[model samples]
Target: MSAAPNLVNLETVSKAYPDQVILDAVSLGVSAGQRIGVVGRNGDGKSTLLKLIARTEEPDSGRVVRTGGTTVASLGQTDTLPDASTVRSALFGDADAHEWASSPRVREVLGGLFGGLDAPSLPDGLDSRIGVLSGGERRRVDLARVLVGSADGRPASVTEGADLLLLDEPTNHLDIEGIAWLAAYLNSTKSAIVVVTHDRWFLDELCDRIWDVQGGSVFEYDGGYSAYVLARAERERQAALAEEKRQNLMRKELAWLRRGPKARTSKAKFRVDAANELIANEPPPRDAAELVSFATARLGKTVFEAHDVTVKAGDQVLLEHLDWMLGPGKRVGLVGVNGAGKTSLLRTLADATEDRRPAAGRVKVGRTVKLAWLTQHMEDLDGSWRVLESIERVAKRVQWGRKEMTAGQLAERLGFVGGRQRTLVRDLSGGQRRRLQLARLLMAEPNVLFLDEPTNDLDIETLTQLEDLLDDWPGTMIVVSHDRYFTERVADETWALLGDKRLRMLPRGIEEYLERRAEAKSDSAAPAAARAKAPSQSTIDRATQKELSKLERRLEKVEDKIAAVHADMAEFATDPGKLTELQGRLGDLERERDEIEERWMDLAD
Candidate 1:
């Protein structure tokens, strides 16, 4: 193992806005091939540090030094692409004059996106104007920019395909497939990275170090996200112990200070000052965040039932012949390709379940059904409304058991600060607006939630916090998220939407669903030589036949014994010792039955 060279360094840098302190004399260093993750709450200078390293912004004090030859590429959280710029122009820049126009590296980066779901051999929609593209589309183009070392499709220069990459919330618009691709790239690439993302899986898999930004300073921790969690908890524990010691010393100091003036002298002046300083510098009591749990209106027995539901967009069938029932406390996660009708099915289900209306079919809902649909596109939120006003419009109050709070109070629990609550929706950042949307939904307090991509634009800390809320939620939820981790964590079952608009029920869970798909692909794509290499069916059948014959006889004997045990148990039901003995034998027979059944399936496969 060899040490990586230093790429960039920040020397006692501090950045501040007119009214708020962002970073306070924070020093950080980036090394070649280092994978660093920057994590903090919103508006906590995570992005500020990135911009400084990216050279897009400068700190008010101190300097950000970099190696003279180092090249850097930055993908910002917000899009500053010119409205007139086309996606092709933004990513491919000016490569026409150079050999870089057909660079395979560029092609390789784009090919991995969405697993060629778009163009099999080349990227698509590059000609679309940046202003006209959807949020997710624009995000893909941004990812392509840094991945290829240029914002515009231009020939890669040393600076273009930079020595270092700075990405803020890079996973904002990505799908599960896209995230997996990125995780693989970052883990493999030798280029240094300083990224701010809320995706736990990304950080856990790729990051070698974590820069935990809080209170205007970075607490550097070795290893990845899981290591950071442990390190942070230990730091807190140590701080608690030190505070306890200080409290005890303070009591003695107070008692001594209250004694007669004879106890005070010129020599003791330093002690008096030290005591006062200790009182002033003592850390305040920990202000833990409030746990979010909402009171739900009672759901009637029949939550909602959809019969023969059909939904179509233009001539494309998004859903067909769907019969679904959403019962109380049920959770379902919807997953599919980017343009797949996951959202369409979610909306259609909301109509059938809550509005009691379904296109081309009869749908019914319980008398007390309360439905809330959280759309992926949050454009319906009034841009002019203050964050608090938006929550107020949804509902004025939220209740959980005997505890209750106004919409404003609940907004704070959702990570909305005092100033942010007063900020207009249009003025908020992408992550902030997403938080606002979450706050509004919580205010609604619906018994059934329809959340489409709720994990989008959320910071990792906030994302986990939202998961905590979802875990405790006692409601029927249909969540459509590209985040497989979040979906697995919160969903009770997975519902998959295949290419043909057919819905597959997954009571077996998402992992099994993916496994079956992989196995099917393997069987279909297996070469003849690979297939022929296996034991002949005749050979397998002969051996299995012999074993099957013996197993059948053994099974019959086990069954006869099981029957005898059942009869004996009934006869000895009043005798504790005999009943226990018979029951234990019955359990052994059941285990044998399971083992034999497993062997039978293996032979069949």
Candidate 2:
């Protein structure tokens, strides 16, 4: 018999920098065909683990074992393509056989990867240099290389052979169609994959498991992103309960020892001594409580208005003939492809000084509208300033009444405790900087808040906290984010910028909008064969029956697990270390049950 494959196994892994420990005694196993999503806040060693597994970086002390013939590839944050390489040449090179380029299988993969972009005929030939391509185009080129694989050594027929594939935010620069295509491709691949992403919808759709790296250790959950979230919340709840019980027991033991008279029996005295020792040695829980709060100020009835507005930057039109009105407590989201001038429109609206002239239109603002803007680049902050000092300065400049509190106190409230408050702004991680910027926003107490890419690099916990804060926000808010979950939760309406300086307002959520766009695209691009083979009513009925059968089978399995919670708990009690394991499993089952039921209802409809 062939030896079993170990997709990934790390033994006694330990990695450390000079000043901090990134991972300590961390061990994890990923089996074949498993799709795992790795998540953590910035600077939590998530990327480091990926590097170790891909052999890009080595662990300080540990053994990383990969099964025989396993191939792994990682798409890192930075593009790894050469400067002068074009998309086609980057994938196949100049000397590769032309037949491979014309292959139907190759064309299919290319079409899926690039959203049906014409692969055969290029405006510029394959010899065209990559230096001229835009950022988004470059990313697509690099991704195409990976999808095509090595052409010289391996025959072009060798496709779908990736044993393991790692992607770090593959959807970073993709548009809606590109993202949909990428999702479908990943789902269809047989590769065992690990993805680190902030996109919750992508994670929910692609990953089978979640590996959360936190506090120098990894927590594994056998479910997708949503299941991981519920499991984590439940674990925190259990931990709080456990701590409370321990405290109560300690209090009771201390009271008994103090109240009892000198015991006549030696056994009673010994027991009292042991109890005191146990109480004295008990350690506090590792995690600290955070007092996170964000409240928005009230605004006037008419927040802002724009009439025949045209925004331009250096003679280039960003938005033309635009008319908009903002009301009190309105929540809006702005979305567009990269370089589509979303940021330019925002700048024109937030132009307080009127230094630059508007392009052929008028924009109006309410007299009492207090606006605060969070830019994507974070240029307003000074690198020399300490984290706490930034918050203090914002509070003082805004003339907020709560300026009496020390900088330390403010920092603590924003989840920056210990020596982190004194850390220079330049030293903070991406997530920390974002949080500090948010802290400044809270201090200003703006009636209208404009946030750009607010969820970038934020962990699930921070994202949850932000969602809660925004849910209760009283201000008229406008946000620009590609994160579907954030947009769905916070946005009441969406403004999508189409080409030619045009904007369309969509009342429905992002997912609905994407679905509609997909349908429209399909309707517009229907092939002759598809039209000819249009299904009859009977055929449609048969297809629906088949889908319903599959849905019913899935629902039945989910129901069976829901009925076996007691059995799961009994199995959980078998081992002391399995307590956490059991809790995670139970959470996964419950979430699956809910999702299956929802899907079943939809299928029935």
Candidate 3:
């Protein structure tokens, strides 16, 4: 294959603030139409690099070179729309410029964007003010604006359209469907994209190259996120092998030098001197692993129980008629689309219900169960506070003992250090703030922990560490996440918030639940297709009967397992060892029964 065209290049780039350097002598190149993902631990200057490219921030030294006159557009955490501007004006420049607003094509586009939901009437007819929109709604409007501007509309020149897009955490407020749509759109486009995100699945699916910024340097890998991981592991393995060989050679040289004067010839003396010099010059291997420890306490058998619970905000019902019983060691995952009230439900369970009361039923929390909550937005922590001071404050509030830990120490545990703790939370990177939030959450010795999108802004290593930590945690957990990999690895049960104020409990995880739901949907649609292709009534009936029989056999197998589990329970107390084995078998059987029964119900519907 021919070499790819270099679209953007950074030469000897270095950024510094006061005495600390964020990026030092970093140089990299992006080829045309290359989808590059930038990843690193929080505060590693991944965002800084993007800023330098987008010209949002200037570097202390070095230059960014673009081979082509590619117009770049960057979307940041904060929306840049004027306070009083309407959505249409913010996107299309002005009402007069947006001639497409009156066209039927525009309405069709808007309908598609909103997933065929009824478009809320623009109060002033596309001139409605934006100040009244909710934060999530504003983000959606911002995205819509970008999409329209990039397409044929006001500011319609081809040159005005973005050739390169820099998106930092674009999925921040997006739901599952929105994220999927964005991914599909990006994949279908030829725009050179540089995205800074902590979503592994997004990076894996969209990026053609990976740029890892770590320890004041950038390492470029010519592959996807998973390939980058494999490359890093292999590099570490090779380094380890080389270090071992050097150490062995040094040991042998030292042993020879320790022999008598007979071994101290000119050659022997030179070899000894070389060995000593090599040993002195050798640097220790980098200790890259992060060790995060949370002093979480264990709870009693019964953690929490809710019966016929209804949670609502004002008159809006989030979830109703729900009965949930969580044991001491259950790890539950709350999975749903955005605005599905996952956060509200979690807050209700966490007893942050002073503003909104439970409509009906009772919530009984275990006496010894202490709850720790991590909100989706880390804005709960004071932005002006230093990282260490924030952790210290949380430690004090939680009554942690007088063995005060420095911010550096806490950050080191979270895989961050090097003057980052001294930086204000406002100045800290997104990942840095996330780590600080996690550190603060860990300081609370809660047996039941609730996390809202905890995987956001986390690196693969950090994610792995979190999984290990959660695995070792003897606490009940309710994690709200859109990450399928994380949910599959960490959760034992899944709760989905379907529309119409309904919630369903799935025994399996998000992946299995989605699979079963898809299968059921296909099954439900097949009869209509069969009817359309009917040759005769008798032939159609025969085909339908065969299909029904296949389904019945599957149902019978599930019923047989349920019946077998009941029969096996009758012999649970016969013998000591045999009873223990039978009891374990019965538990497995019960879990299987629940999964099968749930799927069967969906199929029946």
The parts of candidate 3 lying over 4 Å away from their true place are: 1-4, 56-61, 94-126, 149-161, 240-297, 352-357, 376-411, 415-434, 455-464, 483-489, 511-605
Q: Is candidate 1 or candidate 3 better by lDDT?
A: 1
Name the candidate that leads on lDDT. 1
RMSD of 3: 16.8
Scanning candidate 1 in windows of ten residues, the lowest lDDT window is 284-293
Clashing pairs in 3: none
- Model 1 clashing residue pairs (backbone): 90-152, 91-152, 91-153, 92-152, 92-153, 92-154, 93-152, 93-153, 149-160, 198-460
| Per-model root-mean-square deviation over C-alphas | 19.1, 19.0, 16.8
Task: Estimate every model's Cα lDDT from 0 to 1.
Answer: 0.67, 0.64, 0.62
Runs in model 2 deviating more than 4 A are 1-5, 94-99, 102-109, 112-126, 131-135, 150-158, 241-297, 310-321, 337-341, 352-361, 380-382, 396-415, 500-502, 519-605
**TM-scores for the candidates:** 0.69, 0.69, 0.65
Of candidates 2 and 1, the better by lDDT: 1
Superior candidate under lDDT, 2 versus 3:
2
lDDT of 3 by residue, 320-394 (tens): 887888876677888764445676677677772233336777777777777888876775667788887888776
lDDT of residue 538 for candidate 2 = 32
From the highest TM-score down, the ranking of the candidates is 2, 1, 3
